[model samples]
Target chain A: MNVFVIGLGLIGGSMALDIKTSNKEANIVGFDANEAHMEEAVSIGFIDRKGTLEDAKEADVVIVSIPVNVSLEVIPKVLDIVKDDTLVFDVGSTKANICTALENHPKRRNFLAAHPIAGTEFSGPKAAIRGLYTGKTNIVCEVEKTAFKLQERGFKIFNDLGMRIRYMDPKAHDKHIAYVSHLSHISSFMLGKTVIEKEKNERDIFDMAGSGFESTVRLAKSSPAMWSPIFEQNKENVIETLEEYIANLQKFKELMQQDDYNAIYKEMADTNRIKEILKGISIKTS
Target chain B: MNVFVIGLGLIGGSMALDIKTSNKEANIVGFDANEAHMEEAVSIGFIDRKGTLEDAKEADVVIVSIPVNVSLEVIPKVLDIVKDDTLVFDVGSTKANICTALENHPKRRNFLAAHPIAGTEFSGPKAAIRGLYTGKTNIVCEVEKTAFKLQERGFKIFNDLGMRIRYMDPKAHDKHIAYVSHLSHISSFMLGKTVIEKEKNERDIFDMAGSGFESTVRLAKSSPAMWSPIFEQNKENVIETLEEYIANLQKFKELMQQDDYNAIYKEMADTNRIKEILKGISIKTS
Candidate 1:
């Protein structure tokens, strides 16, 4: 099989590596608007060749792993060029915009909207790793809209990469992802900004940062190019989550300001139930 | 040397294990309000035997690692019982209250107020690990209040645990830690609660929780018992930090609600400087 991965950055480069690792015969070609990323991807052997949109015409699969904004802009172009039977899919963080963008495309049947719920804080071709998707969940939205053969091909690729699959409506997928993923990025970035602004001494952050701060702030290190678009595309849902998050923080602040130890204790205890909820999600700490 | 560790849960238990790991001949004993924890500490080899406050009176070093509120209540009592030469120290998250509680004690000179900036989400004896303090910072507050000989002993133990030391006033330590650590716990807990409330389907959280959510919400898994009192003691500082944090989130939310894409992009782009701040903290993501 020939796989053409556009945007040879972290997710795209990682997918290229994993596909080749799973199938030795798989020929992977990569494309990136960033010349430096393309060079790094090729030098790191993430792709067998550097390819173009013209290459999509011959690909058995075309994976769009660019930023959410770029993915929305590029999906129609990919659908226009790829073979009718080619399994074209996007691994964008937010799905609704891309799904809506391609809803009326003539070759919409060739496209599958997928989001493999996996990533690290790092980005770019250098951040690519082979087994990132293994043991992770892959959410596919509006699967029925895609042709059966393309859906089958997409599932096979996800399965080959050791991911569990689930289906959801595109709108629902974006809403939930805003809470589970997008909000996290915002919280982390804001936290990092808050601490940096308050503590002008960078050495203090370095000396005092424990694993708690590291884990909580990890997504603060994600690429601005990738994340700024995700926050922009999923603006409504992100706004809702942020409002609730801010309200929650404000309530806790009020309790603290009033020296309401009982209320503060109860608030923390109530939220501490996340231990059980997160355990259900396989986020085992011990 | 004889070492008596009060409150043998995660932090104290890990301290015992680390001391033993570094010096096999150091006889370590433990005391805890929970009998099960005392037994678990002994069985896990975190301590040679379970002892009492009376044991602290005779030990060369007395370490109190109870909840912040409990530490404030117990430090003066423990100081009254300990040998005059014993190096008494408490490892509570908040320091100001404990320092104030023991300020007028006859044996106050022996009491060292220290907060080790290290921990995991897990709690209890089973969560104890041998090298938890390695490469972490141990902040010693109000060092001048401790006798020179006792401070020397405290320094030796932290150095043996492979921890760097920093000195600060108790007031400053409480305020700084409220921003860096206490506020993080509250943010994580609230984020978890907001997501749980929004996503009524527990399965969706399980299915969609990627590394981003896992990292951002990890501290929500911390023990409520351990954290509740820290918030209670550091209430003012926590309230102040939370106010600023909520204000920032609210501003971002309003921007998103107004569909100000450029404003949203700029907000994220500005906050993305957290990458540089975190890098300064030596948090290597890739």
Candidate 2:
């Protein structure tokens, strides 16, 4: 298979690497508008060659893994250029916008809207790793809209990559992801911003940061390019989640201010049920 | 030297294991209010034997690694029971309350206030591991109030365990930690709560929980017994930090609702400075 992946950053570069590693017959090519990333991806052996959208005509599969905003603009362009047999898919976090953008395209049948629910805070080609999607969930929206053959090809690829597939409507995918994914990035980024603003001394942040701060603020390091459009695309859901999150924090703050230790304990204890919830979904670390 | 650890959970048990591994001459004893933890600590060889408050007086060093509220209640009692020359210290996250509680104790000079800024999300004796505090910062607050000889001993033990020590006033420690440490926990817990409330389906959460969610929500699993008092002790500071955090989130939400993509992008881009701030902290992980 000849695979051409756009935006050779963390997710796309990782997919290319994993595909090549797992399938010896696969010929993986990459492209990035950022020259440094393209060079790094090539040097790191993440791809066999640098390619352009023109090359999509020859590729068996074309992946749009750029930021959501860019993907909305780029997906139709790729669909217009790629061969009818080419299975074009996007691994974007927000689905409704991307799906909406290509809904009227003549080659829409060739496009599969997918979100591989796997990523790290780190970005760029250097952050790419093999098996990033392994054992992770991949949400595919409006699969029936894609040609049956193309949907089958996507299934084969995700299965080969060791990911479980879940089907959801594009609207539901956007709403649920806003709460589970997009809101997390915003909370972490804002937390990092608040702390940095209040504590001007970077040394103090570094010295006093325990595992708690590191864990909670880890998403603050995510690419702004990738996340900004997600919040914009899913603005309503993001706003709802943010309001609830703020309200929750305010409630806890009020409890603390009143010295209602018992209430604070009860609130935290209630939320601690997340241990079981997370364990239910958690990938085995061992 | 004989070392008695008052609490046999993750921190105390891990410390006992590290001390035993590092100092072959140190005989370690542990006691916990929870019998199950005490048994697991002994079974895991975190302690050579189960000891009591009476044994605290016989030890050359006494480590009180309990919940913050329990630490406040127990430190004075432990100080009253320990030998005049015994170096007593509690490794709680908050320092001001514990330090103040023991301020007038007859053995106050023997009690050293320390907060070792290291931990994983896992808790209890089963979570114990060797070298948990290795190369981590051990912040010693109000050390001038400690006897010079006991302070010398406390510094020696931490140094031998591969920890760096920094001194600050207890009040300053509480305020700084509220921002860097306590606030992170509340943010994570609320993040978990918000997501769980939105996505009632635990399977979706597990499927969609990328590394970003895992990192941001990691501290949600922390013990309520442990965190409740830290919030109670540092109530004012925590409330102030939460207000700032909620305000930041609200502002970002407004931008998102207004569809101000550029402002959203700029906000996240500015907060990306946390990448540089985190660099200065001693994160053992790459």
Candidate 3:
């Protein structure tokens, strides 16, 4: 099986590693616009060989794992070249634009719009690790748009990689993910911005940071090249989440000014239910 | 050595566990406002025995680990009963209010204002774990106000627990903590509130949540009983931090509205420096 992975970074590199391990016969051909990343992925042994975009024509399966902005630019080109029987899937964060872009493509049946809800704060080929998608949720948007055989092939790979699949409409996936995923990255990045600005004068301010601060700001370390395009593609939904988040902070501040600690306590206690909600996500995936 | 832990929650209970392990001759006496917690701490083996407020006079060291609002209420009572040579230190999040309240106490020298920067989102006796303070920072405020002998004794305990100590003025500690610790909690709680509120209508919204959302919102699961008082005491600084945080979010949102992807990318790239900052904190503490 010739499995070609495009854009060799954290997601692409990790997927190649896992697929290589699960399918003994899988030949992992890797490509990235950044030649350094392609070489690093090869040296790291996640890539069996380096391939060009033109070589995607020989792939039995092609994994599109580039930034969403780049996905818009390169995916149509890949679709223009791949054979009819080739199964192609993308793991971008935003889905609506990509799904709509390929809607009228002649080889649309060969492409699958997927978002595997898995990542770390780090990026690049060096950040790749085994079992990156294990016990994680892989959301598939517009599953019906892909050919039946290709869908079956993708599911087999997802199962081999230990991912639980959830199907949803592309628009709904973008809106809901704006709340769950995109808003988290924005909030974390801005929190880091706020604290870093303050740290300018107070050199020891971070000395007092605890695990709480570290956990909340961890996502601020994510790749800007990857996230900026996501925020661009889901502009409306991301802005909406930010508005609601900022309003909540303002209201919390107002409660503090009013000396209504009981209200503040009630609000925190109410949000504590997120523990149960997150626990469900873990159990459902694991 | 008799170490009496009042308010047997995460901090106090974990301290008792580590102190017991590190100092073989030390006796751990636990007390809580709630009788069940006191009994549970005894059963968990972190607390060697149950005691009362009056029993503090027999203690060589007293650890005040209750909420900040409750600290202002109960700390004076503990100070009044402790022996002149006994060291009484607090592990509350807010330091200024408690230090101010005890500014002129007859036994002020016996009270040490300390905030151990160690904890998990979980609370109570059951959440107690060994080595919680190991390699974590412990902020000591107004150390000069503590008697030389008591300060020596407190430092000895901190050493035994393997904690790194940093000294700061109570006011400065509260102000810096507002940016690092308190503000992160508010951002996380608000983020959790925003997402959970949306989840009310979209029952499966959480299914789309990934590790990014989980990490950013983890602090929202903190005990309200523990946090409300910290906010109430650090209200002014917390509100200031919130204003800065909200302003940053609004600015980012405006950039999105203007389709200024380059500016957004710049902001994220700048905040990426926090990775280096946080790395320094981890290395300093560890």
- List model 3 lDDT by residue over B30-98, tens digit each: 889999998899899998999988889899999999988988989999888888899999998999999
Candidate-wise lDDT, in order: 0.84, 0.85, 0.92
lDDT of 1 at B250: 77
Task: Give the TM-score (vs. native) of candidate 3.
Answer: 0.99
Best by DockQ: 3
For all the predictions, what are the DockQ values? 0.62, 0.73, 0.87
Q: List model 2 lDDT by residue over B1-286, tens digit each.
A: 9999999888888888888877899999888998888888888887999877788889999999988888877888887877788999889988888887887888889989999988887789999887778888999998889999999998988988788998888888888888888889999999988887766653454556666777788888888888887888888888889999999999998887788899999998998988877776635423
lDDT at B170 for candidate 2?
87
Question: Where does candidate 2 stray beyond 4 Å?
Answer: A201-203, A284-286, B201-205, B282-286
lDDT of 3 at A40: 95
Sort all candidates by lDDT, best to worst.
Answer: 3, 2, 1
Docking class of 3: high
What 10-residue stretch in candidate 3 chain B is worst by lDDT?
A: B277-286
TM-score of chain B of each: 0.96, 0.96, 0.98
| Candidate 2 residue-wise lDDT, A83-142, digit = tens | 889999999998998888888899999999999988888899999998898888899999
Stronger candidate by DockQ (1 vs 3)? 3
After best superposition, candidate 3 residue A81: deviation in angstroms? 1.0
